[model samples]
Target: MLGLHKKWCLGICVVVYGQLLINALLTTNKTWNELDWLDILGEGGTALLILLWLYFILAARPGGRVTNLMGAGLLAFFVGVFQDALDEIFHMGASTPWHSVVESVASPLGMILMTVGLYFWRQEQGVVNRQLKKREKLFRQHQLVDTVTQITELNYFKYHLRIALSAKHVKRKFTLLLLDINQFNRVNQRFGNAEGDRILHAISELIMLNLRDDDLLSRYAGDRYAILLANTIEAEANVIGQELIAAIEHFAFKTLQGERVRLAASVGLACAREDSVDSILMRAKQALALAKQQTNSSALGQLVAV
Candidate 1:
């Protein structure tokens, strides 16, 4: 969509430039200062737009040889635009050495910067290609599954759960932790949806940092998150719960008004026996309800058994 829009805009620019050239030729006054502010603004604006379009294409497109070639084309486009914009804004008469020097240097500098950007872009694409190959096996496995979205959700749960259950089934011990942001709706109501989104992203990053690579983390619902721990009993889960509570307690988030505001989370944990995933999740939710029910709770955090 962006590419198409850019092409249409470039076409309009060509038409306007053609009309301006014809007018310049037909009129008696052909001097440089005869150019109006409207012409300079229109031509300069078009040049800037072309440069912007080139930058977006190189920066945002997926990595590949085709993208590399497109990036090179963008470099050429930038050179053309730089020269055109300089011509519109400056009078490069035969006597003005500085004006000629500016005109000569602008195009080459644009080309050099664009070329450097493309080189790094190509290297970045190589890294992306390797990562894509690693994910290909998982992608194929996903195609065999009925629900791809569900499998993605289950990736952080079932994958870890299988390892945990296999290692500790004989002992019949494990725990599930559920964490929810308190008064999250109030943030959206008071500030705006954009502010709410930033809070959610920040909280998610914080939770992810606290977990082991082997642990499971999932965004279970809006303002709610779940974690499944391996070989962890109710007491151990409670200890982890306290650590999480401390982490959030120490966090100070900045509001839209540039004021510092503190936020808290309510957590619930449940120990697992010979239980299925659904059962464990249900018990964890119940524990979370109990935590939220506590009175005079500076911060709500609790642990319970299934």
Candidate 2:
């Protein structure tokens, strides 16, 4: 995460330095009597709060579109608040057009940008929440989260699948993709379960990276994973399943001893119908059985679409 956000730190430094330069150039000497105490308190407080916000945002979030938006917005906010604070300390003559522009224009523009950024941030969170729903039986509890993959387990996946099945606006056309690593047991036997656990964790991260942010991924038990793709058709699900299979097949995970271990995955794709989540899962399981059968005959497993 530090490596991901190193550039943002540089950008923030630039903004801060630029603001300091502006303050040095434009600010005037004002006596304590000339400064309005109430305005100083208000503007200084606001600026401090914005600075804290900027620090938190950069420190907390990874570098991405949403992070960029919020960072730019926070920068704008700091600039606005800093300018406002300067208005309290500096005695800028009415003839100066620049100070007036900073005083009048910066705050609202910053607010507008921040509002826009927040809107996009909420949209991003919606996608995250959709994915989180699959891994959580109840939204608020953190105990149910899988410690290894940082996803949910089978019980949580089932609980939410049922809710999705019963939603009024349900498409009745969702898909579930189940992926099981071929020869996962051999990795444990060869390297040990600790190494195997690391491999599973790596594989789960790879699968999540390939999937849409709204798609749900969970550890179904042991080496199997289940994904819930809402509003997806069988054809699309097949494409996704195939992509997952290909991705896992291509992934070269390194063992602690510096040996590379390539893995192949069997994938099952099954579309939901006007039936219960249990029935849908059973169909996916059946598809997985076919995929495993095919894997036994070939070096790499193919996606079995049902």
Candidate 3:
């Protein structure tokens, strides 16, 4: 079946071949009991879903240049996910070759492809829904991506938020998670804005990795990011939010001068209600404020103990 899609399949097959060769040269297999089965399930499940989507994309679409381009983009995502699931079975230590290379490159490459696809998809939808009105002026493609963080800008996020809200079903629910980086300005003052910008980019990438692909991530403003999660209730959003926070916490970012930086994030959760964008944003802002306050208190207590 894949043989029919030549170009699309070629790129993915090459990546798989290289990955296999690298693993053969560098990695050792973990014992059955030592493997993290749960993590494998999560990562493998994601890969399976991407593969299924790829299959549907090929099966449903007619042969065309656009279809092949989309297929190639989807293949990048599949490779990234496939690599992640493979990591669970192999005990690749800190010295693993191409460990950082493939993930750092492929995932973002796929993300950019998917994001561009979303923009074109939105433009196509705009023709069908002229009611969007003045909102079209805000979406100038390149302008919708943040300069520093490279995620979608606040305006772009609002655009997607409108779409998500409008497409809402009576039975289906979507939730929003707002996250603020703790003591971000202090990091800037201490390590210069260059380092701070790098941290923002890293945090943004980390948040993206934790996302379910369907989720929307945008830089709400400085040191703050917003995520729109589909089919999520408050409880599920809370779990996902915590996972993001944990991912940020565990990320070991280093400065130019060899200083290790510890990062923490506070999340505010809000679910869609009455389909009002402003209303949901306000709730998320309030929750974020409260979370920041609690984070501040915890820091204060730790300082006092010291």
Candidate 4:
């Protein structure tokens, strides 16, 4: 594309150069000094436009071949415009030896700058093409899996509830598990927000890795996560909950001061009933509250029937 643009610029320069030559030789009725103000404005305005385009391309699309080429082309085109604009305002007569030399230099200089910019633009396009190819592959893989819909919170609950009820006909049940990191606010208060964010990301990844492919995970709230286990019974859900507790218990996170901080999580599991999604979530939350009250510590897990 940059090559095409450069070629178009070169063509315009050739046409403009021919017009200047013809006007110098045959147009005896108009003197150079008699040039209209509009003529000067037109030429100067074009030069300014070319310069602005060059500036934007350089500033916005750095490290790209098309941008570099367009930048160079604009640079060359501006040179011609500069000379033409000056010719309108100043009567640099054809008889002056330097006048012809100056006018002749603009076209060639513009062409050279444009050519160099196009070369870089082509190199940048190659890199972009590779990135696009990788993106295409990722898109194809995503099509094969059942992905969650990005919707409002209310809609998400409604949709998941419908799915759960439909699955019950096939003897498939769902379990909801909520995990809250203990004293997470203290970490933010003591270490920093950056450390807290890192810890959250690490724990989320661990939970994701341990879950079945059909399980859904979401950031429930600050320091808390909700997991939706598909086709899971209460007994199986308890086993999974135990594994998650053990995994988090064994994880050794380092503080900003390089001290190892032991972290624990409180888990609440609830089996889904024929009721709404809201009811299931509320029961799980109540169970979590009970666990926290009974144990008086973060490292607690409970399973409550809804």
Superposition TM-score, candidate 1 onto the true structure: 0.49
Predictions in order: lDDT: 0.61, 0.82, 0.77, 0.66
Residue runs of model 4 more than 4 Å from their true location after superposition: 1-162, 166-168, 297-306
Per-candidate TM-score against the hidden true structure: 0.49, 0.57, 0.53, 0.49
Candidate 3 vs candidate 4: the TM-score winner is: 3
Better of 1 and 3 by lDDT: 3
Please write out the lDDT profile of model 3 over residues 188-271, one tens digit for every residue: 999999999999998888888788746778899999998888788877787788888788888899998889998888888888
Per residue, candidate 1 scores C-alpha lDDT tens digits across 91-114 of: 545544544454466556656666
Model 4 residue 51 CA deviation (Å) reads 20
Looking at candidate 3, the ten consecutive residues that score lowest on lDDT are 297-306
List, residue by residue over 122-184, the lDDT tens digit for candidate 2: 999888776665445357556657877887777778887898888787655688888899988
TM-score of decoy 3: 0.53
Selected candidate, larger lDDT, 2 vs 3: 2
Candidate 2 lDDT score relative to the true structure: 0.82
Clashing pairs in 1: none
| Tens-digit per-residue lDDT, 19-97, candidate 4 | 5575566434346668787977898888778767765665566444565456656766776666677677555665555
lDDT of 2 at 266: 93
